[model samples]
Target: MKWLVPSAFMAVLGVTIAHSLVWGALICPFFIFAWVRYRPSMKIIAICVGVCAIFMALTSVALSGHESHLTGEEQRLPLRLAQPFKIKGQTATTTATTVKGESILVKVYLQDEHIPQLIASNSPAWCYWKGELERPSTARNPHSFNYRTYLWNQNTHWIFTLSNADDFTQCQPIQLTIREKLDQIRQQGMNHLKVVFPEKLQPIAKSLLFGDRSDIEGELLESYQQLGVIHLLAISGMHVGLMVGLLWWCLLRIGLTKEKVRIVILVLMPLYAIMTGASPPVVRAVSVVMAVIACTMIVKRITLIQALCLSIIVQLMINPVLLLHVGFQLSYAISLSLVLSAARILSAKSWLESVFIVTVVAQLGALPILLWHFHEVSFMAFVTNLLYIPIFTLFLLPSLFLLYLFSFFLPNVTFLLAGMLEKSVLLLDTFSMFLSTFPFATVVFGKPSHVLSFFYIIALFYMFSRWESRAPFKAIIFLLIVLCFDWFSSRFNPFGSVLFIDVGQGDSILIDLPWGNGTYLIDTGGAVQFGPQENQFSVGKDIVWPVLKARGITAVDAVILTHGDWDHIGGTLDLIDYIEIGEVWISPSSYEKETMEELVMKLQNKFIPVQEKLAPFSWAAGNAYFELLYPHDRDYEGNDDSLVIWAKFGGLTWLFTGDVEEKGEQELLSRYSLKSDVLKVGHHGSHTSTSQEFLTKVSPTYAIISAGVNNRYNHPHPEVTQRITEQGAVMLGTYSHGAIEYRFRGDKGTFQWMIP
Candidate 1:
C-alpha cells in the first residue's frame, strides 16, 4: 500500500518524460523520500521501480507508434466516422479513422447549413471520405497550447480538411458499431438535455450529466474558474455516488432482490460511464466502484486507497496518453489526497470540520500543479467551494436529476421545476460574478522554476504528514511563508527587458525596469474583428496575459496606447481588468475617437488613473527616461497622430514611433534630434511609414517590426526593409521571429529572438 504513490507517480513520469534521463532524478529523489517517510519493504520498493520501468517502455512504444503519414497533400481514403460531426455555421469538425484504423481529425466548410440537417437525419456511420491531410499546428508562443502535441498524445497526428461539405455525398454509409451506437445515444441525450433546460442552464446541465463542457463559455465560466470551484461544475465521484444511490433506491422500490440490484448496477455502470463521455474523473469513479464490487463477490475486501491505485495503474497502462491531460492530472491528484487523508476526515467531530479539512487538503494537492502550468491560484477558492459545493451537490444535482427523470414523463411538472432551476442557477451565477469582482480573488504566482516546484511539492508532502498527525497549524504557517518567499523573489529580481511581442498585425512593447522599478506597455495588441461574434478572441486575455503572467509580471505601472486603433489599444481594455494598473496614457486627441469609448470607460470604472501625453511631457521610471515627441496639442489624424516616444534605458537610446508615417517622421526630424540604438519600426513597417530619410535621421543599430504572419495587410514592406538595411540597421519582424526581446541588467543588455 505504501508503494502505490511512488509507483503511480513514476507511471506519470514514464508517460511524460520517458525519453529523458533527467526524469530519473525526479523519480530517485522521491523514492528516497518515500523510503525515509513510509519505510516500505525493500521488495515492495523494487517492485515499484520495476513497474516504473515497464510503464516507461510501454510509453516509448506507444509514442513512437504515432509518427504521421499525412503529407499535407490531397488523398482519397475510405474513412469511418469516429465521432459525430460538430457543426457550427458553415464549418464543422469531427474525427475519422482511416482504413488502417489511424485516428485523424476532420475539419470541413459546409456548402450550406442544409447539409448538417441532412447528415443528422442519416448520420454518417461510415463514409469513403476525400480530403487533404495535414499535421496539426504547434504553439508559436511561450506558454501557448500546442495542438500538434495534444493530438499526438491521443495517437492522432493528422487533420483531414475537406474542401466542401457536399463531398460527403460521394460516399456510401455503412452499419454502425456498438460503440458508435452508444455515442449516438449519448449525443441524443445531450440534445435532449439542452431542450429540457433553459438556454442559460443548458451548458451546466450538459457538463454535469454528460461531461460535455463545450457550450460552457464566457464570463460565467471565468467566474467559476476564479472561484476555484470550476471542478464542482464537472461530473466527479459525488455525481457517481448520487447516480448509483438513486438507481439502487429505484430498483429496491420496484421490489428487486438486493443481490439482483447489485448485478444490475454492475452491468449498467460501464454503460453509464461510456454514455457520459468517459472523462478521467468519471472513469476513476466507475472503475473504483466496479473493483470494490468484484472484491466483495470474491470474499476479499479492497481498501478505498487500493481501489484508487488499481484504477490509476489500469487506466494508464491501457491508455498512457491520459497522462498528458490536465483534467486527468487534477482528478487523480485531488482524489489521492482525499483517500490518503480519509482517516483525518472521518475523525472530524462535525460535518463542517470534515468539509474544511477536505477543502484544504484538495487545495494543497492542486497548488503545485496549478502554479506549474497556469502561474496563478485562486485565493477565494476555499470560500467559494465551501459555499457552493453543497448548493451544487445537495440542491442542484438532486434537482437536475429529478428534472431529468420528470422531463421524460411529467411534462407539466418539469416546466415549472425547470423555471425554478434556471432562476436558482441565475441567482448563483450573479452571486459568483459578484464574488469574482473582488480584486484579490486570484493571485498570480507565475510558472515556478523547476527547483522551486520541487521544494513546494516536498513542503506539501511534509504538511500532509502534519495534518495526519493532528498538528497542522505549523505546516499551514510554513506554507504561507514559502508563498511569501515566492512572491518576494519574483518582485525584486534585477533583470529588466524591452520586449517586442508578437501581436499579429499590431504593436506591443514591454518595458520592465530593473529591481521592481516599474513596468509599461507601449500597446496591448488587439484582434481585428471582421464581424459580430458570440465570443471574439481577446489578445489581452488569450495571448498577452499568458505571456506576461508566465514571465511573472502581474502589474503594469501604465499602458501607453500609441493610437486609438483596436489593433493597438483594444487589448489594454481587457488587460486592465485582470492585471494591476497604475495609469494609462494615450495621445491627447486619440481619446475623442469612438474606438476609445470602451477603453476610457473601462479605465475610469476600474478607478485607474488615465492621462494624455504630448510632446515635452518627459518622465523617468527608475533609470528609464521617456520623452513624448509628437501630436502636440492637436486633433487626431489616425496613424500620423500616433504618440511618438523617445527614451533612454539599459545604457541605450530608444525610439518608439507609433504608426507614424513619412510625413510625421519628417516633422520629427525638423522639430527634434533623433538617434537611437534600438528602434520600434513605425506602423508595423508599412511602406507608407519608415521613410529612408527618416531611417537615416534615427540611425538605429537595431530596428524591430511587429506584424502578423501572412497578414492580409502585407507589412514590413520590402521598401522599408531596404531603407533600414541601407541605414546599416539589423531588421527583425515579429512575423518572422515571433518575439524580439532586449534583456538587460543595469547598463548591459543583449538582444534575443523567440524563434532563434
Candidate 2:
C-alpha cells in the first residue's frame, strides 16, 4: 500500500515528462501531501528529501557549468547579421577542453574567409582576421569551424552558439599530409571492399561496427520493427553483457584468477562502451552492470533492482536531460521490469525452460511500454526473441570478440568469423521475414491517449502478474473495455477528407474516405536538395508509417507522387514496399535518372501499376470527389509538372499544389478559377511560389504549410508567412503541430481543426 502511493505518483510524473513539461504541477501537490501525511519517520523523510535536494543541486550545477563555457559574445544579442559565407577547409584536429565543470572543445581549421569589414578590438580577432600565427593555413582556404559548445535544440529556429575568447582557443596546426594517406585507405575500402560484400550484409556490418545506418533501407528497418528485433541494431546492455561474459570466460580459460577476471571485465567493458560512442543509455547500462559485478565481488550481496536505481540516480545527476531521452527511458524501464518480474516466474531446471521464462517475462513487461510509444504489437515477438536472443548473445557476440582479437595477428581468422556471422544473420533475417508475412503477426493500433495508455498498461500488468490465477479474467475484461474504447475512438476519424500532416520542412498529406473506401497519400515528407544520401523512405518508416498505423491505415488507394523531387517522392519507394498501394501516380517529366526510377522498377517487378500524368480524371469514394488539376503535356520540368489536385467532400473543398514555382502558380491562376476551403502551400511557401495573386484566386480560408523546423533554406519564409496572414487565413504548419486534421460537418456548413 505504501509502495502504491509512490508508484502511482511516479507514473503521473512519467506522463508529464512525456508531454515535455518541466514539472508535473497538477500531480506535485499529491506527492507533497503523501510525503507529509505518511510521516514515515524523521530519518526516512530526511533521507528522501536529502536525495531530492542533492539531485536538484546536481542538475543546477551541470546547467550552470554548461552556461559558463559559452562566450560573453554569445550571451549578448548579435549587433549585426553577417552575410552567409562558405569556407573551404578540413578538420585539422580536435581536443576537448574542460571549462568550469563542462566539456568544451575547440576545432582548429585552416580556413579562408574574407577580411571582416569590422573587426573586434581584441588580439585574437586580429590574428583570426589576418590569418596570423594563431591561424594555421591548410590546403584549403576559408574552412568552416564547427565545434560543440552545448546541445543545440533541433526543434528551435535560432540556436545560440558560443563565439569569441570565452570559449575559443587556438590549437597547433595539424599536417594534411597524414590525412591524404588515410583518405586513400578510405577510398580503397569504399571502391573495392564495399563492392565485395553482399548488399544485405551491409546493415549488419554497420550496426555491429560503426553504429552507422545510412545504408540500411527503410523497408528493412520496418521489417525489423515488425519482427521485434530493432534492439539488435542498437548497441545495448544485452550486447555489453554478452561481451563481458565472453571476456570473463576467455580470461578464466587462459589461467586468469577469479579476481583478475573480474578486474579485466570491469576495465574492458568501459573500453568497449567508449568504442561504441558511449551513448547515455549504453553508459547507464554498463555502469549498472559494473556496479552489480563489483558488489558481487566485494560486498557479497546487492539487489539488481537497487543497482539499477542507483545507476539511474548517478546518470540523472550527471545529465538530467538524459531523463527525458526516449531511449534512456525505454532501456531503464524494460530492464527494471525484467529485474522485478523475472524473479516471480517459476524457476526451471532445464535450459530451455529458463530461456522461455526469461523471454516471456521480459516481453510481457516491455509490451505495454512498446505499444504505448509505437502503437505496434508483434504477436510473434516471444518466439522471435527465443530464437534470436541465444543466437545473438552466444554466436554473434562471440564472433565480434574473435574478430576484434584476431584482426591484427590472425587477419584471415577475422574474415572467417565475419563470414560465419553474416551467414547466421542471413538465416535469422529469413526467419524474421517469414514470420512477418504470417497473418495477424503484427498489429498496429493508432496512437492512444495518456489515460487510455495508462489503463492499457494496468491491464497488461494485471494480466502478467496473475497469468496463472483467476485475476486473469479481470484482465481480459479490462482489455475488452480498452478495445471497445479504441473502436469508438477510431470512429471519430476525419474520413472523406484531406489532411495536411505537419512534418516540418517536408510534405506528408493523408486523404481518408469513410468505410475504408479510398485512402490516398500525397507526398511523404523528405528533404529535397539537402543530405542527398539520406533516404526519405527511412523518414517515412520512422515518422509516417507510425502515424498511418496509428490511424488504422494499412493500404492506400493511390500513392500520388507529384514529382521525382526528394521531398515529393523520396519516401514513396519505402512506402510502396511496406504498405499495399493499388497504384502510383507521377508526372511523366519526373523520369530523371534518380532513386525514383529505381523505385519504379521495384514496383513494376511487384506488378504494382505506375501511371504517368493522365488527364484530369475524376475519382469518387462515396460522397467525396477527387480530380487532378495540372501537369498537362505542355508542362516539362519536374517542378512545374507537379500533380496539382482538387478534392471536394460535401461543401468542403481542398487543393494540393506541389512545389510549383511562380511560373507554375501564375499559369494555374491564368488557367483555372481555383477555390478551396483549405490549401497546402506550394514550394513550402518559398518566395518562388504562393504569389498573392494566386492565393486570392484560391480564396482558401485555411492554409497549411508542411515544412521542417530550422530548415537550412528557412522555409515558409517570413514574406510568405506575412502574405498568408494578410489574407486573414488560418495558417497551420507541421513544424509547430506534428499532424493536422480537419473534419467537415455537412449539416452545419463548417469544419473543425484538429492536431493529433
Candidate 3:
C-alpha cells in the first residue's frame, strides 16, 4: 500500500496535537482513512506512528521558539517592514518584524497622506520604525472568531500602532534580493492596474494577477463568499493552472522546446508565487505543479495524489503551522477529494457532467471547514459555482490578465475594455447577489462539537471508501443522518438564555427562548464614529450578528431600540440586511426629525413595524413577558426618556433600563414600586443614572453593567457600584466579564461569562 497518505495525516496529527487538543481531535479521520483505505502492514503503521511522534516533538520545540520575542512593555522598537504598507484614506496596516525577527501587525493613523507613497518608494525592508507593542485580544464571545489565535498561528503575537505617521523613519537604501525585486514588480503592476482600470475592474485585476484582494468591495466579496466562489477573487489552484497553461503555450509559440519550456516555467513558478504574496492557495498550487514538473522532467513517474501529498508533507516540514490556515486546509481537501474521485470524474459522459462532479466533490471537501469557521453553509454553492466558475475561468480572469498587460504597453486602450469587462462582471455579481437574497440560500448550523465532527469524518470516510470500492452506496445514509443531526440540534435544545453581550461601550442583550420558541434582541450595539461611514466599526455585522448566528438563532422576533443614542440603536439598521426582523420597538416619539422619519420609513418599507411603546405597553414572546414601565405619556426627549423594560422570563423578574438617567428613574419610582431579580444598570452605570434610591427600590439580586473596557467614560462608576453592592446585589459588568449570560430552565438558572 502507498505510504504518502498516512504520512500526510500523521504529520498533521502531530502538529495539531502540539498546537491544540480540540484541533487534534482530527485523529478520527486519519485513523479511519489509514485503516479503510490501505489496511497497511503492522510495520508500516509503526513507521507512520514514529513519524507522528517525531513531528510532535519537533512541533513542541517549535512552539516554544514561536513565542513572542518582545515582552510587550516596550514603548519603542526599531522594526523591519515584512510587507508593503496597505493604506486607504487615513489608516494603514502592514506586517513588520522586530529586531528578533518576530512578526507583529503594525497599524498606523496616516496623518501624513504621503507616508505610504514615501514608504513604498523606498526599500521598505530597511525602514526604521518605533511603536508601542501590545498583546492581541482574544474573542470575547463564544463561537466568535478568535483573532488572537489567528495571529499566533501566523507567528504574530503582538500589535504595534504608530501614533503619528509624520514621525515615520526615513527608509534607507539596500540591495534588493530576488524576492524583493519580484515584490516591487508586483506592487508596480498593482499600482498600474489601479490607475488604468475603473474601481470595479481594479479589484479583479489586482487580485487575479497578484493575489492582493484588498481592493474587493466588502459587499461584493460577501456575495462571492455566499456563493462559495470567493476563491476566484484570489490566486488559487485554478489560477495557477490557467497561468501555467497560458505560459506553456506562449513559451512554445516563441520557439522553445517542450523540455526547455518546462524548465523555464519551473524557474518562473517560485518567482510568481512570491510576487503574488505566497498565500497558502498559491503556495500549495505552485508546489504541486513544481513537484509534478520535476517528477516528469526527471523521468520519475508519479501519480497526481503522490505529487499532492508530497507538496503537503514538504510544506508541513517547513512550517507545521501551515495546516492551521483555512486556505491550506481547503486547498488540500479539495485537491485530495478530486484526486481520490478521479475515476468518477473521468467516467462522466460530458464536460458539463464532469464539471458538476468536480464541483460536488470540492464542495463536499469544503463543507465542514466552512461550517466550522463561519457557522453557516451556502446551500447555493453548488449552483453558484456551477453557473459562475466558467464565466470567471473563461472570460473574467483572462480579460483581467490581458488588461493588466495592455495597461503597461497600450495604456490608453485599457479603460474602454476594462469598463466593458466590469459591466459584465457587475451583471453576474448582481445575479449571484439576487440569488443570495432567497431565505434558504444559506443555512446556519453553528460549529459542530468534537464528537459530531468525529462522527462526520467517520461517515464521510466510510462513504468515500464505499465509492472507491464500487460497493452499494448505503454509507451515504449515515453521512446524511449525521449532517441533519448536527444541523438541527439547536432547535431541539431545551434551555433558554438571557445574555448581555460585550459590545464595547454599548448595550446589546439577547433573550432566546427554549426549544426555538423565540429570539429577541434588546439593543444592537453601535460605536461612535468620527470618520467616514465606510470605515466605521460595525458592532452589528462584526459582533452582535456573529453571536446570534453562532447560537443558530436565524430570525429575531423583535428588535427593541431603547432610545436614539448611537450606542443604543446605531447597529439596528446594519442588522436588518443580515437577519430577519419581525418588528422594531422604540421609545415614544413623533418620528418627526429627519433621521427618525427616514429610519421609520425604511423599516416600514421592509414591512417591519416601528412601534413606540409607552407605559403599560406589554407583550408576550414565547413564554417571556415584557412590560414598558417608564415614559407613560410624555414625548420622547433624549437619553432621559429612554425605554424602561420590565421583563419576566425563566421564572425571574428583570429590569432593562436603557440609558435612563436620574430624572427618569425618579419618575419610575414615583409611578411604580419595583423589585427585580436582575437589573440591567442604566446608562452603563454612569454617575447620572442607577441612583442609590433607584437601586434600593429595585432591590435586584443581580446588577449588570455593559460598558467598554477602560472606556473614556470609566463606566460602572465607583459610587454607583458601591450603591449596588450596598443594596446586596451581585455586580457584573461586561467591561470586566466580557459577555454575561444567565442560562435557565423554567425558573432555575446558572450564570456564565465568556471571560470567566
Q: Which pairs, if any, clash in model 1?
A: 505-708
Q: Which lDDT values do the candidates have, in the order given?
A: 0.82, 0.62, 0.81
Residues 1-756 of candidate 3 have per-residue lDDT tens digits of 157777877887888888787767667456765577767788988888898888888788877777876777887777776467776656777887777777889888756658777656545655566667777888887777788988988889998987655445465555666776787788877777778998877777788888887776677788788777787788988999999999999999999999999999899999889988899889989988998899899998778888888888888888887877888888888888888874843367887877777787788777778777787887687777777789889988888888878877877788888888889877887887787777777888877877777776677667777766766268778878887888777655679999999999999999888877778899899855644555556888889988988777778888988887778776777788888898898887836545556778888988898988788888886778888887786576778878888989898999999999999899999888888999999999999998888888899999999999999988979999889888899999999899999999988889999887
lDDT of 1 by residue, 1-756 (tens): 555656776676666566555545654686677679878788877887688889989978877887766566657767887467886545678888877788889887666767777566546656766668877876656677678888888888888887555666666667887888898899988988877778888788888888887787678888888889988888889899999998999999999987788889899989999988998999999998887877777787788888888889889999887876788888898988888874754467887776766888898898988888778899898777888889988999898878988999986778778888889888998899999989878888878777777778778887888877878788878888888877766776788988888878788898888888888898999865532264567788777888888877888888999899989987887787778888888888787888887778878888988888778788898888988999786788889899989999898999999899998899999999998988899998899998888888889999999999899888879898888888889998889988888889988999887676
Instruction: Summing lDDT over every window of 10 consecutive residues in candidate 1, give the lowest-scoring window.
Output: 527-536
Clashing pairs in 3: 505-708
Give me the runs in candidate 3 sitting further than 4 Å from their true place.
29-33, 112-122, 125-130, 164-166, 169-171, 466-477, 527-535, 590-594, 617-623, 671-673
Best by lDDT: 1
What shift in Å separates residue 105 of candidate 1 from its native position after superposition? Answer: 2.3
Worst 10 residues of 2 by lDDT: 138-147
TM-score of each: 0.94, 0.68, 0.93
- RMSD, every candidate, angstroms: 2.5, 9.6, 2.6
If both were scored by lDDT, which would come out higher, candidate 1 or candidate 3? 1
